[model samples]
Target: MIHSVGNACSSGEKRVRMPAVAGAFYPADADTLRETVVSFLSEASSAEADKEVQAVIVPHAGYVYSGSTASEAIKAIPSDAVYKRIFLLGPSHRAAFDGASVNNAFDSYATPLGQVKVDREVCEALKHADPVFTYVPEAHAREHCLEVQLPFLQVHLQHVPPIVPVIIGTQDLAKLRRIAQALQPYFTSDNLFVISSDFSHYPSYEDANRVDKATGEAIESGSLRKFLDALEKNARKGVPRLATSACGQSPIAVLLLLMEGRKDLQVRHLAYCNSGDAIYGDKDRVVGYHAFSIVKKAEADAFALTGEERAQLLQIARKSIDYELARKTDLPYDSTKMSPALQQHCGVFVTLHKGGKLRGCIGNLIGFLPLYRLVANMAKLAAFEDPRFYPVKESEMKDIDIEISVLSPLRKIQSIDEFQLGRHGIYIIKGEHRGTFLPQVAEETGWTKEEFLGHCARDKAGLAWNGWKDAELYVYEAIVFGEEK
Candidate 1:
């Protein structure tokens, strides 16, 4: 029969009985750890509520080494959740194990914050598979890989859920896959999957950034084979110094497999840095840490753009030239520059082209500026002030292809559920002012709608997203066109 492994806590006991890293790593005193954890959580950037997170990869080192990166991912987790369990998978740094070691102890793991019950049923299911798995307490004793994540979860989740912690110590890809496949039933929307890993080791800060970026690119591109190749190539560097990343390579493979069915599994890089960037720099030897999230897909037909609309935008660009030449004086391009009749109903597009290449493009989603006034104002700014591209030159004007996007009115939606990338341009309206643009805004640059919205939110709207909830939304059609100078 299954049973408790550690000493049971008495009614008079103030805390659960579990090992603490104490003075060796973070502050040993409970109050000190609490203050540090609370401070870190407070500094975290807020995440959007509409953004559904399915999986994440975080780093595991002392707070001084990788806490910031790990904290970013933890903060991004959906703040409101009631998942049945959390499956934390990490690589072993201390003892050796053949495949997976399920922590079968009955005692709850105590963190500086509180206790997380070990999910006995899930642990037993993974262990019952036979010779490939075992229940080992020794393997986890000195391992900080999984232990480091516990505090973050405690702080964010608030309500403690059962945990299935596995320390992977082998390079058996096949075994890892089989276990992952076997656990498929457990990875549902109601369950959260966490994979802990750190990037580059020993490479200079510059070299580490380059190396880690390659892995990040592969992860973002959703290429499992490429990720594996990166690891293998790093391993072949030499016998003494293997290029190991996210040490739990096998676990990552399984996560990728489970995430395959999802098309919108976006990889968000929350934070990245090598030991070199830390306050106390370590140029000679250092490990890299990164935090990332994967999101699920909610709709189909998300990224297609039509051609006729493309032509309409360019037409608007040409018209902008006249507006700019008319108002090139000291006055800024605000509402007062236009005639009374033209002030209230113009659709504007600020488009830029540099050295014959399309550059920065920004616009309104509705007819706030008159068609002519909007086109003219945006064209001038597009050419002269676009931050993405060098300013348009008098010499390059002949080669520049100016485009304008006159937008349709926005339709307020109840939720993100109504979003259509190629069809609906979204306007997120709140308070006195608002920001808007057509979905084609992203298509013009060939960026995915998700990528487009992220830039627009940060660059256009300047909204610090708490998550897409009941915010007012408007969708509009765009007539885009361009012409030769």
Candidate 2:
């Protein structure tokens, strides 16, 4: 039978869980720690999200190794953001136990930077609410994964809310599901969930890249079965020295369980690298790191771009491809001259047509970078990187026409009745099989609702024509503009 262990809190004395790997994993000095974290955040890519960030998946290795990647993930949370509480979860490398452990006994968690208050009440309630939660001091005694994340939170967030630290010691899916369900009430826009993990431990550089990419894609799919299958597949490949695909598999599974039915939550991959990418590291054996942001996007019609904004995007797209094809420097523009809508982040797709024929198309469903920058990147991809066609040549530039599609956050739909043919685009999902047709696709093809879904399932997602009938359906609207206009 399963059981719980350790008391929620002690009645006798004040308790503060102090740092364990302060001098090792990160700087122990207060000022140095502050400087290091600040540098990481500043040096991270400038692709800050203009969307609401609800959670993040970050690496837990030493600051020198994974700090840049971790900072990239944390940077997704807006600088002016405020939260009610933060739920911190990570796999415990130091202890082996039957269930997960919640930290209720400690009043605060101490790092070199400062002390962050522990949500003792919430922790106690979690312990009482589910047998899957307990207080195992050993689990966190020497754990550096979650502890290292505290400093990033302390330095980045203007108001670092109280945290409820959870350590997962079990690989059991049932137990992880229980933990996710217990924490479901706390997972909301008002709170932030930081999932601490690293990817592809002790694998060769090339193999680590392959394994980590597969694992990241599985996580982005938000399918528990797919994630488990990816892990099993990686193990079966027999990559030399590959100990694990993702060290925080249990915690990630818990997060995926929470995301099982939420369509508004878009998982965006931010950055990736291995220790081999670091300055003082070996390429033979490397540990990989990946950064992801789980955004709770606003409604599909939250805001729309104006005509001027749309025109500006078209100009940017044309220039992006021109610069790339001409082998010139990147397109440059003054940020002050741009509209607020252009600066806001939104998912965008770029389509290219040559002499009124389909040339190339590519896009990200949920983009975290600024609208202007995302459009430029996608435009280049459509012109040069779409795998379906050969790279575009300078001679083809004159005949190329560019079209941009800005998409809103995806929301789950009950039935085809909710999907308007010309106004709403449909995204179909069935297990690992998924595909999408932009809203304009309906207008372009004049396809019926069933035909639209059928084509998308078969041609795009590799599912049977009838596969979308029993699959999970989602609908999103897009703002489309083209150079022809």
Candidate 3:
């Protein structure tokens, strides 16, 4: 759920960041600004895509020069779509720093369009997470890059969600990656990322086109090395009248870093032009503008079970554990009464926690038996056979909470980067040894992705902390549920 910034600053002094370039960059009047943005969007030739557009890289020059191109890119974010919040990532044109800055003081930012609320909660979260994120008031005070995009969003979107305005101030690549890591959680479909940048600044019209094309293609490649090399390669050519390839390169790098190794996204070049293309502008010196959309592929649930099915499985697990406690040799089940879903084969893990401490947990990586049978067997094994703890006592069952993890098939991961923390469980296996931690382990431990793998490799797999680098790594997701009480 989203909390409005108004409520956050209601008791405190209300602070609004008034637009710094409303009249100079875009229309000063709200109606004129609305008309200009709407016209540009309507004139965009880029067809609305079928896939979900998660992010956009657009130019942030004055409306007369880059407005059309920016509109072309913003169009990719469907007008009817709603987001939890929009993160406006732009370069710090006025101030420089080591990392990005989040708005800590502002309640909202005002444009000719209206006041766009700032997400205070998100800002606080980032600030507390790491030193890389902090309040640099000077960085945001008069920044025009993010300011210019507010109107386009207000006009095109049906409802403008609260924004988390971030100014990327670092030129250091490693710091950019750290900034990306901090922002990764919000880089999902529920949120939108607007990367404000202008390409090929102060170059001749012809040279701007040539340079911008290479740079845009590099961004489209979604390879960090290629993107950075393209910039370096462009500089090597010593194109006359060139100042910088992309003024917003820092923020763009942050976006590229966040997008690293993501295979499900398709980047499309929406529109391209330059200030030279503008009637009021000249060809001698031009700033190129390009709009690109990062679209996410459709996703389907890997596995799903009905509410009744989940209840039945839990009952089967509890009964199986009870039978084991009573020293029963066999578990009796009526196969004819079982649903088809229960008959499907899948790996399972059953965990027992007594008074919030792990008592016993055991699971199988491969399922040769039906799901119902697997759950029963795993439940019995977890309660009585886990090596880390003694068998669960029958009297303790009343206070023990049982959790079941039903897993999808294990997939051999090409890179450890593919193993998302808090989402996928990783299994590291060397020739004679192997170990795995469930997906929830990351949530429970609050470990970074690297730390998660290191622990699994060292402690769980009986290998070195960096042993996963050489060992074969596989990842899997689970539909985890626990007992109601």
Candidate 4:
């Protein structure tokens, strides 16, 4: 049986929770802490900050080791957004107790940046909602997991909201689910959830890389069952000195439970690294860190081309390919006959196949030109400019298969479940390298979802076989049309 703990401090006196490791884990001085956090946020791409982020998974190791990786997720939150509360959850590293330990005894948590107020009302509500919630002062006295995240939140958010600090001490999934259920009403857009965790502790650099990649993929997959299966599998592999795949598995599991069945919410992998990569650490054995964000998709931002528009684009691609191979100077199309939809700008890809084998493929990811022009240009490029294949001769034009894929605007997804095999194509980007596979690739290769992602990560993006697990992954639906159709 679970029990509730914590003093109901309704008097509203600001009971302060002082920093436990201010100088050791991070800077002790206020200015230095602010400067260090600002530098880390600056390293992240500003474009990610524009997202409507709902939650983030960040590493909780000391600043010298995992700070940069944690910044990738923290910086992704738009500074201007307003939140009623922030739910900060982490696993207890110092104390062992049952269920969740809420720190309602403190009115505010103090760090170098400043003191952040605790949401006493929410804490009281949580206590009433579930028996698993209790005030365990010892559980948080020396815990570094939740403390490490406060400075980042203080610096990145334009307006700091009161936090519901939770220390997960129990590993029971049933109790965690009840806790999540209790919090579900408050898990709205007005609140943010931050799960603090570090991955693959005390393993060789290579082994950590391998194990962390699998763990990351499982988390991003958004299937709690899959994540647990992978976690158990990694534990059984017996990697030398590997303590755990993730330190905050329970907190993450709670988030996963909250996210299940919500198609609008998507998870994006922002950054990943191990302690071995840090200047102060060695490559022999290291701890791993990863950052990820859960964002909400705006339906209004996505655009879909009509059936007639798709047909016209297909015709344009086929005609362009035919003309290019014939050495003709002009494509055979009446510009006046094109509909308004064809005049719209959209990215397109033209693929050519001979005897059911890939002959050539080419396209642009950004929709800079009109649909017809983009398709025509890509068709010519696919036939002759593809470096992977020889230029198509006029004789082969009759036997060639032309296919056009009209794409929707690419939107970053939070989970692998967002990708529908044979329906939505995937795009992966990491640094300057990127790889894309059309929805049909899944159908042709008959690969499972994991295999499909593995191929794109390894073969196309030049990352490792499990690279997509940590790389930025986007999903887009395509309207595919073929000559036979």
Candidates 1 and 2 compared by TM-score, better number: 2
- Cα lDDT tens digits, model 1, 1-485, are 11222224543533233544544445556677777777777777766633567778888777877877787888887767767688888887777777877776644676656678787766776776444667776766666677678877877775657888887766766676566654554555566788988888777676677677777777776666788887766566552332565566767776765553234456677788777777887866678888888765575223222454344335445545544545544433344433333333434566666565566676643333344455655676777676777765566656666666555433345566677787777665333224555656666667665665555555556665532233455565655555545
Lowest summed lDDT window (length 10), candidate 4: 1-10
Candidates 1 and 4 compared by TM-score, better number? 4
* lDDT preference between candidates 1 and 3, better one: 3
Highest lDDT against the true fold, candidate: 2
The residue pairs that clash in candidate 2, if any, are: none
lDDT of 3 by residue, 332-376 (tens): 466777997787656689888888889889887655467899899
TM-score of each: 0.57, 0.60, 0.64, 0.60
Candidate 4 achieves a global lDDT of 0.83
Better of 2 and 4 by lDDT: 2
Quantify all predictions' global Cα lDDT against the true fold: 0.63, 0.84, 0.83, 0.83
Q: Which ten residues in a row have the lowest lDDT in candidate 2?
A: 1-10
Give the Cα-based TM-score of candidate 3 against the true structure. 0.64
Q: List per-candidate RMSD values in Å.
A: 19.1, 17.7, 16.4, 19.5
Model 4, 116-172: lDDT tens digits are: 999887787788767899988788887788888999989988899999999998889
Worst 10 residues of 3 by lDDT: 1-10
- The parts of candidate 1 lying over 4 Å away from their true place are 1-17, 49-51, 129-131, 235-243, 300-485
The superposed Cα distance between candidate 2 and the true structure at residue 410, in angstroms, equals 17
Report the lDDT tens digits of candidate 2 across residue range 1-485: 10112213333576777778888888888989999999999998887654578789999999989999999998888877888789999998988898999987799877767778998888887877688899998998778888899998888888999998999999988788788767755566677899999999999899999999999999888777899999999999999999999999999998887765455677889999999999987889999999999987575235678888888899888888888877888564456788877876567899999887889998876554678888888988998899999999989888888999998756566688988998987777664565788998887898888899999999887999988888768787888888863
